[model samples]
Target chain A: MTQQNPQYKKVVEYIMSEIENGSLKEGSRLPSEKELCEMFSLSRQTIRHATGELEKNRVITRVKGSGTYVGDQSRPRRKPRYRSVAVMLTYVNSYIFPPVLQGISNTLNNKGYSVSVSFTNNDIEREKRTLEQILSSDKVDALIAEPSKSALPNPNMNYYRMLEKRGIPVLFINSSYPKLDMPCIRLDDEGIGYEAVKYLISQGHRDIAAVFHCEDLQGIRRYAGFDRALRENGIVLDPEKVIWLDTAGVSDLDPLMDYITKRISTATAVFAYNDEVACQLIRGFNRKGIRVPDDISVIGVDDAEAARTAEPPLTTFPHPKAELGIMAAQKIIEQIENPLMKRDHLFLPEIIVRDSVKNLNKEEK
Target chain B: MTQQNPQYKKVVEYIMSEIENGSLKEGSRLPSEKELCEMFSLSRQTIRHATGELEKNRVITRVKGSGTYVGDQSRPRRKPRYRSVAVMLTYVNSYIFPPVLQGISNTLNNKGYSVSVSFTNNDIEREKRTLEQILSSDKVDALIAEPSKSALPNPNMNYYRMLEKRGIPVLFINSSYPKLDMPCIRLDDEGIGYEAVKYLISQGHRDIAAVFHCEDLQGIRRYAGFDRALRENGIVLDPEKVIWLDTAGVSDLDPLMDYITKRISTATAVFAYNDEVACQLIRGFNRKGIRVPDDISVIGVDDAEAARTAEPPLTTFPHPKAELGIMAAQKIIEQIENPLMKRDHLFLPEIIVRDSVKNLNKEEK
Candidate 1:
């Protein structure tokens, strides 16, 4: 018991005793890496590797920006215990939050881990500040964040980097900053765009207009998909029919309405970035006495719950939003428990058709 | 210097020295009430009174179940500095999380304190467990929670009582359990229900159906309001038209759908419990080939984002979900900074009209 794996045994025994004595406690952060390295008189890398093994054993978790912590292994060893995890998003009062949260909640809850949530309001400053606070506070054991648009400068990359350096686990959902070392859970936005446009094309709509909120990496990918579909279908991308709104600068609908009205001449069918933006477009079009599908067909991404109840319904691409949340939570947990585990997850999006798009053949000639 | 008010002067000097010497960090949990009493060799009640004065002076915050912590005061006085404060929630991915969060963030940020959040996924066990974790972690200075309905069945009431006994401040949102001695930030659910029904009557609807999701104090109030509206209008409540879905037990939509489809009749209008339930009902009706507003008018409570984008566009009661978050955060902060300050807040709900509810006059006879 003391010879071959003495160092390993010592670290394991220390954590186990803490758990048994209820000293480390569940959802509590362990000592810093520097402190552990010093206490063990071992190299920082060696200390981390040992901690990594413990993490893989599900005895502890490393929250990014936050330190490692004892995992939720309350019972005597049997199966790997699911450790506590947290998710941070910009807004939760949308159709997307419940399902996505449900996905994460159900998955973590089943694994015997609790999930905590935070909202950033899509403000980069707020997002960075909240992340820093979470990290410094050492409250959560792991984090899954839907990062603000990559195009929008987030001044908090250093904090995220610090978490990575500490071997804490973090996963990005919906969008991720490419250069970051963190894993991400996202849909094939370009593929979704291509599928959506192809669906509309199959319905015999030649002239399609696409509307998107700009300055977001996700929005750009979606636009790329829309462009690719049009290109593959032998339709040139018409600059006039594409409406791009600077959502980061102005979060109002007036400019968006004016942009859509101007494109009414050449666009008989429209593809929107997301359900919220699509709904706004519909409301604007309706105000001008325009009818959906009959006058102009509209499509959106994110088969949000609102899409189903929107006037005439919204035909759009459905992504595994909640599934993404679940996967992200699972992945971050994996990273926390198994520091050597390195994998990327890509979720696929589905196209859901309803009344928002019209069949050209049904229209009166 | 230690003349007339020797005890008060000594306490003030001790706190100031700790602050200036950087021994008391911002967000750090203060010494326990019993420990402070012992250190000062004073009665526990005297220590409590002194702490109360400090709290009023914005020197510290008492988070129930957590501990007393340095307040978010940026004063250059001869004292230690605290960095920020945070408020936690159970979930943020709903129609209600945003505005309330916005209000909290705005208020807290303006006051130079940072706000952090956490969610418990509505599990009472998790809620209780997380509270303990958050308390020991010493993360935020204060907390504002909309406790789960199941909290009543557990020892959480006693736990919170102990917290209050120790001088920590907590504020409940949306749901109030009188057994807990805490302030609550809620909405006039009954008034909202009555107003929603009154609006439908004004629109010339008679045979209106009311669909409610069961359990919870808020739901009860909303139902009472709905019944009051019908009673005032001399419209008898039809048991057949009142569809109640046990949302507490069943988290999925299948049961809700089954309940809605089985009870839907020749009612001209339907009043749903909330936006989430209303959207589901509309989707169920659409699946059955029934056109909303044309076949049956529908109204929902909670002007959730989904309601605005539902297929026919839901008409709903506009409850300030975000405003509730903000008010709850503010009240909790106030309580934390001033233990003697006691107050309760309740917000009002409004009506937002869209396409889901149709005017009877617009129907073709």
Candidate 2:
């Protein structure tokens, strides 16, 4: 084991002493394996073994594709003044949020800002409570938020206005409440909807059915774009062809699946609000003996893992989940540095074609 | 609309004035809808309309099966000194974390304590950084943590020790580090494993294969229990039939599925670490033209949503997800109130038999 190896112990002790002596500061890049090998006159394997031990001991962090950095415990014992950022999101564990959060955490951590996270579970009441706590905590220096039910008129507007009045820089992500007038970093959700439908049209699919989540502004905007796409194509917007499901409806998809099947029975293609819905629809169709891209073609937004792993692999618009988060962190920090900073970033829609969308033009030709 | 109705407005105005004058406190439960009708001499329909408006306006919250409570903005403008709690978990969004967080947040919010959450993504480095932040923040009164990679030797133990030395109460949820000597509220994972295997054996499955997550103490303990059950049944524990997967293996299961399939080829039943693994195996089997329960039986722990929704619904051991979080919050509060208090809690397992397990005795007869 590396623990028992004399040469590895020497390397570990050298790094430990450097960290203790303030020669190697927290977050600073450590010597590369090649350089370490040269310095210690040891094999590359020994260097790796020592570094691995250091990483496990929390003395260094090895970021993939990035060099190793001096890890935790190097901070000065005396309390240092550092700006803290508060991030509140609808959800933080699964799907897109994980990468988004990873991006935000990484960016902010690199900038030496302490980041604290809170989850609202997409509930307005939880959002209200979280806001109230943030307002009173006196710890947070800035805020990055994904508004709860942004499409709905939020009663928590006063709390946000209060935050503004207090001169706290708050940047919105994914979705922003209209009443807030805050700077936001999000994907071009409407463009995503427009592009997805246009791609379906390119594939010669007309009678396109749509399923939209109606709670957040992103979903609402996407629906708006979907409507515009149909109108531009001189296609009548059939009310029956469009299905609106809220967060609750989305969570328990079993009862909704029957409704969805009935709604899309006459359609040759479907545009789902997200990969989750798209995957679920595909699964539901499988059970009913309907094959994806064979019986009915489907497309979705957000190139989630489900989209890639779904039976037929969905052709979907990619949501810049992590990139958006990184930009949000950078923008929020800039806003913090300069209170006058006012900027909004919108990631353009990019379609990742897989097997879900069928080419009706091939049959026509 | 409720806004235009005079009777609804009257009920709203009454509640608003009561809140403004401090008659109704934050978190204080409101009278039931029936009582409100009696008080206002309004119809039940009108009362419902009024309360719905109140809920939307953030003046009140209506928890299902629970009474409505006075909502945000009821607190005095002057910052009241409230004891704050910090929650650190492995993941906060998907699977079991949502309900667990809900329980913790609800309990803490009800007690007028401020709660801040952080995610570690089950990484020791993130845990170290988060703990360092918590230590430096000096805001947290107590901490409720789910230790990251609890089965492995953790390097962040010193930070936890520092928190203890600072007289800040820390209670662990899900899993606790063995070296910490900290109080934890978690499911009896070992018993769950033993019970799941016993249930499978009761259904007459002799050749059993097991897949275990080896990163956390819960998984390790569960493995121990599984081994005991096999030994008790006089069945030789086949190393080839046992697969020990880490967090990375759990995340990207495609490559591992082949190995798993080959390992469990001779086994009549398989016990997965959790519902996720079980559902993945079922899906993997489906692709290989293998049917669940009909071809091979499967059992898993954590009655996650996927368990219920999996093709053939899974037979799983129930995890006290939210209840554990609630108990953790409650215990941490108790510890905060009395620093000398030290208690540990373990939730016993119960199996939810769905369609996944098949009784071989029926075929034998």
Candidate 3:
């Protein structure tokens, strides 16, 4: 079953060279179909055929959801993999992850590092399993992870310690475990929160409501910042105006928002944890006969794609999504090289003024 | 390290009983932290302690991302596992998948079957890998997959055939490979397409444009139906007015919609593939100063959550999301019990009238 076709043979040779040169490590995933097609200028069929041949030859293995990996699945490779990095994220295709993943993959791929990604769905149990797999696999030299439910007490701390003990450097992205002495690359959530609320306050809105995800460290930090801004302005924080949520609560905000509507009816403005929540709140508000920036003002963090197309566009703060991912990849590689190295970064937020916030002072004047 | 606490002992005993009763099998994942907490009526700390003890004793193994399994990872369990099922999907948390997953899990769990899920991200390479892993695992008694790019010339057909040879019953949901002889539960995409276009025509629309995903079979079939409706109504098809897209193209519709504006300028109505696409097109058209249902009526398939929330609300055909999921689960279980059983269903489409489509006939009169 040997192929005489030059294109097929070329692909096979390219893959073999990639493995031989340590560009594709044993147990590491190969580049995606789109990437392979772009690299070789080959059709999908030729690429699939080449991979099929490679799989039969025991040089590559394909797993359904995780993608294709180097080495054979029939035998587990005990040797430490070369130039391989594993990324554990909440999601790979949704929200702000695409850019972040692209940033991480593009940076690592250019440096000849093989990257394999796993999604935790922001579930602690799933995160624990992912960490255990990476620890036992011996396929990863380093890891970059976004802590799942960072505000909650996570039991996966032991797994992180085990990775550290094994000399496999790990870096946190987006969020980190407060107990773990690990470096993290993330946006300044607290600063973003402060800036969003302060901007809203500058518009002469005294009564403000906030929707926050209590499970995420980012959400908690942002809420803290919101509190600080209100305190500094000599405004008393109304307990009823603040809504604490988790992952599940964010999806169905209608019932909660309806109940919150009456409680926060006196509030003139609402600060959401992120653009997604902000947009949903606006919709939930609209459904209840309340209009944004007219009946009430709204502001949010993370100038995500949703912010631009939102009903009145959203007044938001930049999240530094891709930049954070690139930095995390660079820093993780740095840590892998120098085990003693420690670096943490917090990208400050920049205001992206949109139409969601209303200036009550303008009307008063 | 002995746990003297009765709560911890009781939790441990319950897990042991589950395994003993065959509800939990070797190489199958254990219930999540929330599930355990609910079942035992115990604190998370106690549940963690019991699981820790279980892990230490080799009663279970925890892997990050994938979750905790009921067997040791040090050795591969080659024997066929009991009452375990694996679901392969494009996504678990986004768009229409959550309801589908909930339906499947709820139904399966009620029958004492443990379910594990994997996401393909609609990438063929990832799907291929997922199939290979399931084939090698020997843990899953049955498999349910939402085919990745069902319209594409898939090379993973051999993997499906291999699953069949191994006596593993496979079921498809949402979409299925046309080449594969498998039971699938999905919506009547073609009928929905025809119905949508026909509805627009009934509202006195003659020059209708279409937007569809070329990679998905649903899109292709819908386009076919769209074509049929046009021909039957003595309306000639305009190739320039039809826009075909893939996954990546759907994200940023601005540039494409900008170009398409000129070509589809004469089009009085637009039939979108789904509500997501329909909502984006409405926004795109709105940006281009074209008001939906006023300047041009629009109809979409899938009365998804987006349809109702869309600016003017969307006129769409319904997609039996959760119902399809529930039916797929029941059929898959039937197939697993009787490998020779064959069942395929196509849920009929029903139009949900909304504000997006205008009555052009009234204007003409």
Error in Å for residue B289 of model 2: 1.0
> What TM-score, computed on C-alpha atoms, does each candidate reach?
0.40, 0.41, 0.41
Candidate 3 lDDT over A84-183, as tens digits, reads 9999998722678888888999899988899999998886667878998998888888899989867544658899989989978889988898878888
State the TM-score for model 1. Answer: 0.40
Per residue, candidate 3 scores C-alpha lDDT tens digits across B205-246 of: 999998776556787778767877877797766655766655
True contacts kept of 3: 0.00
Stretches off by above 4 angstroms in model 1 are A1-82, A248-251, A361-365, B1-365
For residue A222, model 3's alpha carbon misses the true position, in angstroms, by: 0.7
Model 1, B224-247: lDDT tens per residue? 687678877878655456654333
Task: State which candidate, 1 or 2, has the greater lDDT.
Answer: 2
Who is ahead in TM-score, 1 or 3? 3
TM-score of chain A of 2: 0.77
Q: Candidate 1 local accuracy as lDDT?
A: 0.69
lDDT of 2 by residue, B212-302 (tens): 7655777768876786787789776665576666565565456556656876799999999888888888888888887889889999888
Give candidate 2's error at residue A73 in angstroms. 54
